[model samples]
Target chain A: MDLSGLFAQVLNGLQYGLLLFLISSGLTLIFGVMGVINLAHGSMFMIGAYLAYVIASLTGALWLALPLAVLGGLAMGAALEAGLFRRFYKREHLDQVLLTFALILLFEEARSAMLGNDFHAVPVPAILDFSVPVTAEFAYSAYRLAVLVVCLFVALLMFLGIERTRIGSAVRAAAEKPEMVDLLGLDARRIHLLVFAVGTALAMLAGALAAPLQSVYPNMGESFLIICFVVVVVGGVGSIAGAFWAALLIGLVDTLGKAYLPEIAGLVVYLLMAGVLLWRPSGLFAPGR
Target chain B: MTPPILEARGLQAGYGEGLVLRGVDIAVRPGEAIGLMGRNGMGKTTLIRTLLGQLPARAGQVLADGRDITREATFRRAQRGIAVVPEGRGVFASLSVMENLLLAARPDADGRTPWPLERVLTTFPRLAQRARNRGDQLSGGEQQMLAIGRALMTNPRLLILDEATEGLAPLLRDEIWRTIRTIREAGLACIVVDKTVGAVLSVVDRAEILVKGSLVWSGRPDALRADPELMHRHLGV
Candidate 1:
């Protein structure tokens, strides 16, 4: 492949990686802290895209739709936590998987009942609809580039929030020992609720961001959810930084592998996960856990 | 007419299908030190758990600072100035020692400065030296110190230490004991649970002995010390 082809692929990989990171970071936090393996996370992503489609069409303002989509996602997450997930916090992982899997089916059916089975699209804000030239014959969408920048900013913000803020410490501490966090005078239940809400919002944000780049459909989140599980496993269960790095690694591998090694592209990310697991057992960067 | 900072009467709790603490009673006034002694499986730790609301109290009451906290969640009890250095330390293994300490550092329940970070570091100098290390990386003794430091950082009105020096070396055990004494001198209510009855008895104002999940005896340390047979009858291995 030529340099421009490589450059375009790299951009594709990064943009895809950021999206995966946005979604998977939430998955990691929920699983790591609350010990819930939510099978419906991808459903939240699908819901985000669908919400953006609905809201943008109604308001004719992409900016307004995005925040509303996030708020919508947060409400959905809180509802899921209070209504269903809360009952399963102390249950076994097997039970959680089954419950969350049921949720995925429930959400998909709900979406179909509300919006029907037809595909939908989100409007690309007119300003970002332009493109920047990569090579003599190649150009990349400015919208995708903007996603890369926005996701990076969000990632940085999330990292600092968890690492530097008092609430962040409570989050980290709660994941380790929920009762112990209570012993420290912070309500573990409140932290769990907050984390579930945030995780859900992040998934929705990714969905909203990705809607302009792809067709929004009922099952669009299925593949991304699988990809997110891969990212979480390869990044370590509870580490956000791990998710960030692993998401990029998987994104680049999947994007470039499909381009250059089309014959075996489908197997590259799984292979990388296996290799990392064989080496570390845990993912590459979970510090003490 | 001030109530005890922590008072439990006929508190009953246990693991699923296996009762551990059967109607245990204990009390601690402000700035008082108490020793809890019992053999393995006798439910000393279970009593602590029930008192802190970590376990559901099957019967009886837990009053803290004159408030009945029997139905309160564990964290709410903690916010009311209940802190514990639980068995196994329960340190945040993924965080640095400093982070572990800071995670629980806040003003006491009354919003007064008590054991600040600087004070905790000064109290446990080894923790200061290893502040940058992760919880899992600390020596068992250091982890114990960090645990106590973490609890103290909360500036709790009542601090409970369960087997604070269980696996430490001789020197470290002494160091832990010394720190416990220092904390007592600093005027904090503390409950020290240890198998070494003599060490615990020496420091505490009052002592209680448990047998088969029931309190068999309780009194000032001098009364227990005066009767050597009491130790052999209740605490002897």
Candidate 2:
């Protein structure tokens, strides 16, 4: 591979990893704090993509769809948590899995009923559609670079939101000991609701951003969901930092493997997960809380 | 003479089939200090859990400031000016000392933030030194202090301490006792549970003995100290 090719591949890997981070971070958080196994999370991503498509088609602007998707995701997440997830907090993992899996069906059915099964492409915003010149001989895709910038910015915000802020500490503390959170006059249910809502919004946001890259379809989220699971497992069940590093590693491995060795590209991400699990069972950053 | 800050009446609860708290009744008045003392495997922890609404009351009612809160959630009870430093300290192992305190900082029903960040940090100099260290990294004494500080941060009218000085050096234990005295002197209602009978007696105004999931005896601490036979029979002190 040439220098520009390598650079482009690296950029693509980072972009892919960051997107994975956005989705899996929510998965890990919900699992870590609420001990929920949200299989339907991918459905939320799909819904976001569809939301992007509909809004973009109507407004002819991708930017306008972003905020609406986020707000909708938050409302949907909070509703799901209040109406469904909190009830399953103490239930068995199998029940949670079944519940969320059922939600995926319900969500997909609603999507099919509302919009019909079809693939739709979102237009890249006109402002960001033009590529910046990196060198005399080559220029990268402007939309992809914009994705990198947006994902990185979101990741930074997540880090600050969960690490530096008081609410972040509450979330972390609740993950360790929810009863303590209750005893501290902070409702654990509210914390769980907050986490769920944020997770949903981030998933939707990731989907809306990627709508331009990978045309929206009926079950695009299934693939992303599986990859997110791999990221969560490789990172650790409930560690945000773990999800981040794991996402980047998997992204690079999967992307580069596809580019260099397409024959076994599908097996590489799973192989990495297995290797990591064999080394550290719980995950890379599960602080024994 | 004022109404009790917390009152539990006929609270019966247990794990599965084994009943641990059997019709346990206790009350803490404003500015009162209580010592709930019992040997291991008794209902000392159970009663605290039930009172805090962590466990459901199978039989009767739990009232906070004269309002029924038996069906309320634990955090709701906490929001009503009740706080507990539960057994094992109940500190968030993932959070730092400062974070632990900050997470619990809430105004009481009167909307008075009595125990602000600065006040709590000043109350526990050891916690102040280790503000940025995670809960698991702290020693037992520090954990206890952090728990107390965290509870105080809620500006609770009533605070409950379970196993206040279980595993600590003599100096640390004395410090804890001193802090309890200060809390009592500040006119906050408190429930202190400890194995150290002398230390608990020194800080608490009233001593209640738990025997087989019930309040076996309740009297002034000075009276209990004078009666070693009663102490041996109930608290095994």
Candidate 3:
């Protein structure tokens, strides 16, 4: 590839990595602290994209739909936690997987029933429709850049929230030693609910941002979900920083591979993940030790 | 002079089909220390589980501060001033020492009894040096101290320590006993489970010995200490 092409591919990788980080961070948080393997997490992303599509169409402003989509995601996540995930907190991991997988089916069907199976588009705001010239003949879309900036901001906020605040301390405690968190007279169940909501909200935000870049459809989140798991696994389960770095790595590898390794692109990410596991079975950034 | 701070009446509990605690009854008065003694698999741990509501009491009552707490969740029971330093320390291996202590600290109504970071450090000086260390990073002795310190942070009316010093070195075990004495002297009701008959006899006011999931003997610690054969038969120590 030429210089400008390589630089463009690199930016694409960064943008994609940031989005993956947004989604995987929440998944890692829920899994690390609550130990709940929520297979339905991707469904929440799909719900966000659909919500953004509906809101943007109704309001005729993409920016106006962002917060609404996030709120919807939070509500859906909290409801799922209180009604379904809470019951499975102490159950086996296999059961949690099965239940959440069932939720994916339910979510897809519900979306179809409510929003129909037609593909939807989230138009970029008119002001951000143009591309910024990086070189004499090369450019990147302003909307995609905006998504990158917003994702980075949220990622920073999440890091601060988990590492600095009193609530974050409680979350870290609960994630590490749930029983001890209970012994402290804190309502761990409430903490779990909050974490689930926050995680879902982040996923929603990612979906909403990606709506303009990708078509909104019932199955849009499924492919992203698989890649997000790869992000989680390669980064190390439950490590936000790990997710951040791994997302970038995966983004670059996947983007560059797809750009260059047309025939073998599909095998590239899996090969990278297998190599990571071979070196560090747990992950590149396993949290506990 | 006052009603027992905690009591269990006719408590029966088990794991699966095998009964572990059969009609076990125990009580702890304010400012008193009681020791639970039994050989391996004699239901001492089971009794602790039933009392904490971690294991369901099939047919009995658990009361905290004269209030019926049989139906209360474990966290609710904790909110009502009951704290447990569980067996094996139960430290969150991934959490920092300060984080573990902070999680267990409860703010009093006036917020004066808060177990501040400094107070915890002072209580367990070892924790001070390793405040940023994860639970799994600490030695067995340090983890036990952290467990006790974590429970103390809750400002609980009743503290229960299950196997408080099971795997510690002799010197560390002595330090734990000294700390228990200090806590009891501070007027907190405590129930301790330990295999060291001598140390337990020295610290607790009363002792209960369990055999085959039944409390076969209950009396003043002196009464049991006077009969070494009793200790050997039931406690094997």
Model 3: which residue pairs collide? A33-A175
Report per-prediction Cα RMSD to one decimal.
2.2, 2.1, 2.3
Error of 3 at B105 (Å): 1.4
lDDT of 2 by residue, A1-289 (tens): 5888877888899999999999999999998899888999999889888988998899888888789888998999999999989899999999999999999999999999999998887888888888778888778889999888988898999889988999899888887787788888887877899999999999999999899988899888999999999999988877788888989988898999998889999999998788878988787666663
Candidate 3 on A165-281: residue-level lDDT in tens?
Answer: 778878877766676676668898889898999999999888888989989987888899999999988998777888999999999999999999889999999998888889886
lDDT string for model 1 (B1-237, tens) is 789998998888888898887888888999888899878888888898889888899888999888899998888888888889999999888788989988887897578977889999999899989988888898888888999999998888888999998988898899899999899889888899998888998899999898999999989999998888877888883
Range of the 10 consecutive residues with the lowest summed lDDT in candidate 3 chain A: A175-184
Fnat of candidate 3 is 0.74
Query: Per-residue alpha-carbon lDDT of model 3 for B21-42, expressed as tens digits?
Result: 7887788987788888888888
Encode model 2's per-residue lDDT on B127-205: one tens digit a residue: 9999989989999999999999989989989989888888999999899888988888888999988888988888888
TM-score for candidate 3: 0.93
Q: Show the lowest summed lDDT stretch of 10 residues, model 3 chain B.
A: B107-116
Full-model lDDT, candidate 2: 0.88
What is the TM-score of each candidate's chain B when compared with the real chain B? 0.96, 0.96, 0.94
TM-score of chain A for the candidates in order shown: 0.95, 0.96, 0.95
